[model samples]
Target: MRGHDRFNTSLPDDLIIEIFRRLDSKSKRDACSLVCHRWLRLHRLTRSSLKIGASGSPDRFLQILSTRFPNVTDIYVDERFAISPPPCIQGRKRSRDNSKVSSEESCGSVGNVDSPYLSDAGLAVIGNGFPKLEKLNLIWCSNVTSDGLASLARKCTYLKSLDLQGCYVRDQGLAAVGQCCKQLEDLNLRFCEGLTDTGLIELAVGVGKSLKSLGVAACAKITDSSMEAVGSHCGSLENLSLDSEFIHNQGILAVAGGCPHLKVIKLQCINVNDDALKAVGANCLSLMSLALYGFQRFTDKGFFAIGKGSKNLKNLTLSDCYFLSDKGLEAIATGCKELTHLEINGCHNIGTPGLQSVGKSCRHLTELALLYCQRIGDPGLLQIGQGCKYLRTLHLVDCSSIGDEGMCGIASGCKNLKKLHIRRCYEIGNKGIIAVGKHCKLLTDLNIRYCDRVGDEALIAIAEGCSLHYLNVSGCHQIGDAGVIAIARGCPQLCYLDVSVLQNLGDMVMTELAEHCPLLKEIVLSHCRQITDVGLTHLVKSCTMLESCHMVYCSGITSAGVATMVSSCPNIKKVLIEKWKVSQRTKRRAGSVISYFCVEL
Candidate 1:
């Protein structure tokens, strides 16, 4: 006990913080919240920024800040929803004399109330309160009129970054906020469907020269004239994301010709033919990141240009671009050596040779996603395994051609791999998964879903060798109780398991599986029709941590079983029940019980 205590205490605060920094925002919040009040105090003191805008509970956020917590410098007001009356309407309480229209009629559109958590009044309250805010990410706040933005701009004058991505703002809002925030360096207007070139022209002609980053992603309304004029004017623009159309070669050429300091560019679903990309490559010498996913006109020519130019590029994505072939990969291999992440999803023409070139040359690569690359067979997969030694993630989902050989190669060569996804690889059987278990001993996520040939043998291997935390063997028809038993015995750290569509998993298997993996938190056993009350009873009794359970099509389970699980496993956050129900009251009670229980816990 003393030794265990000492080991636990040995972990320092700095170490924990550094670890937490890598975690997602939600997980970090959860972890911080879990480590006792002392940790909470420490976290509040150490945390540099706090954003509580997803559901905009400004009161809750302020409550957290009131307790001598070091001021949250970076506050994000995620899209604010309007709970108040529409602009045209006066108050919430409607008159009995006048037949009040529905909320949509009052607001002109239902989307105005979709985020229904915040109001302009609420945001003004925040602006009035947190005056020292540094960064504000206001993404998809469609209902937040220009008045709210202007108020925020006036209040948070110390803000270095302001995000207005997807808001219903026009020229007046842009003109107001643009002149107000003198220190604003970053602005994201991606999919701000209401923004016109007139508004953009105002920003460009006036204060655009100060901007370091700007986003216009999926802004289909932007034309070549506006972009050309704007690109030439915004001399400080370093990063940009365009909607992949309208802004043609001339516009990009204007940008390259003007913004000498431009670095990162993302043109998703754009028609940037070879010449445009080449122009960017030739001009943007300081370019660091480029995502040209879904650019139908981009081909090997663009890759060649990138190889020749853009020497500082660190991230590249080429998803759904059909024209990229082996030659382009060869060019990329020869050119960019500092690449850390590469995504080539849906590039069917890029076969073994191109993959081999990439793997062999891009030694520093940490994450490689070849999702939906069907031409990647055993030989190609093997080459990747042998080449990319530093690879951390290998995603080959929906690549049906990979059989035993490819799986074996990945297992053997990519020892550093933490996440291996071979989902829907129908050709893979026990042989490949067994190989994976044997080689990638440190594997945390193993997704072998829809691999029908994989059965008890594969699970047995994984259970024995791999220290897996997340296991998804969904749709593996051959998997039986023996396999679940192996999972129980081998993976003590197992937290998430999906055995959906497993016909052989009966009540006994569920009992054993739940009992075996005490740390089981999330289980998806959908279509396991053989499971009855007995299995679920045992599951509820054993796996108290079970948060989300998908028991859809589980015909054997009755409302009594559900009630037992809900009552027993107080932490069961989500229970997806499609058919079975005792009563409407029972259903409502279950939902209410779960909500109350989760909050209390």
Candidate 2:
């Protein structure tokens, strides 16, 4: 007893609390709390954030949570809370009928008034419990209405950021928020269908001076009136995202002329012509990031204005802008010489000349993505590869014109590349892949999905040089045991691998994986009919750290093999296989240990 007491030196309370605060994992903190009563009290005092799921009784749970972690300033309510209604409201009938409830009162009439799932009463409990709450995220809480939001706003007066995505809150809630939360800076109301111009105007008038970031994407009822209100009131707004078909050039012009200090703007499916874009370029000189999607009306004139004016632009994304051609891209590339990231999707009119201009001008470019740009061919890619030597990530999807020459150029030039993804670029084959494997020594992630021309030669080269952590050659029918065996032998740190639909892969590859890749966690062998029970057993017995294993449609695996894997692999959590291969006994026993998914016959 004396020896044990001598070793038990008491640590200072402040030092113990600091140690608890440094722990990153919740489970680790919980374990530390179990050591003694003093440690548990210190852990609770240090914790400031709590994420609650929708499984327990809200009243009782919130009571206990407030008692234990009284200092928590942030709370995130899971989406599952809306899917599964609270148990207290399961059998109770709503006080108001749906037919009698008007559109304005729908939020308050969702369920029983006493129930916490849909009523303002539930929010009152949270507001009363956590008065110091600064950030609250209630994403997908569709049943909560304006009354609940008003109650929460009145109590949590210090709130700075509020995310109510997919909620049923309308104008009344915004009015309450503006009246109560004076320091609010960040607000997201994306997918809030009930919000209209009236509510937004109220919110803007109240909190416009303090607001920095505002997102009202997909609010169909809002029109030019709301944008005008925001521009007139919200002078300090910097980041804005607006998605509405009703908004046109007049609204965009107001925002551009009013918000001169804006840094980021994202517009989706808005009916704006070159005039609006020109206004943005001329007025918002501080803009650094811009994303435009499905704007068919914009032409080269708008892009030219942006390029000529917003010279400090660093990131730009253009998607489905069919009318914008090579001239527009060239203008942007020449003007925005400091661009670091560029993404072009479904812009078929922009071809080799535009890309060549980008390659020549944007030497600081680090990331580039070109998707469904059929007109962009090998010459364009070659120019990019030759110029953009500092590029780290490159993604080419459905760019059928890209061939071996373009890929080889990229491989040789972008020696610092870390991630490369090529999907459905059928023109690229073994030669291009071999060049990548030979030159890209720092490459950690490589995905060549559905590129049938890529085979063992490419994989063998990668295994020999690149220390890849993730490799996915799924749908590459030419890949076999020789390439995979080489990977197993060389890339010992490989964590994720997918060889689905590779018919030539057999037990030899599994044997090699078992012998070499002990850290392997997740593997997908779907549709590989050649893999047998022996190979499955060998993999599970050695790779004890495997958490997820998928072998769907593998006819050679039987119930015995499935049972062996479920019993032997201690860390296995998810196993996906054919329904017919699992026996009733195995299913019953595995139910407690792992989640098993069956592919229906």
Q: What alpha-carbon RMSD in Å does predicted model 2 have with respect to the real structure?
A: 5.5
Worst 10 residues of 1 by lDDT: 592-601
Q: Residues 1-601, candidate 2: write the lDDT tens digits.
A: 6456321266788888889888889899999999878888988998888775554334334554666787889987765653333333333343365434232232233233343443465577678878899988887776679999998999999998999888889899988999899888899988899999998889888888888888877888988998999899889989989887888998899889888889999998558899999998999999899999999899999999999999999999999999999999999999999999999999979888899999999999999999998999888878888999999999999998999999999999999999999999999999999999899999989999999899999999999879888989999989999999998998999888999899999998989999999989999988999999899889987898988888877877888888988888888888887666778888887865444555445
Candidate 1 residues lying further than 4 Å off, grouped into runs, are 1-72, 78-120, 204-210, 233-236, 260-263, 579-585, 593-601
Q: In terms of TM-score, which candidate is strongest?
A: 2
Query: In model 1, how large is the Cα lDDT of residue 290?
Result: 84
Clashing pairs in 1: 244-270
Each prediction's number of clashing residue pairs = 1, 0
Provide the TM-score for each candidate, comma-separated: 0.81, 0.91
Model 1 TM-score, 2 decimals: 0.81
Which lDDT value does model 1 have at 164?
76
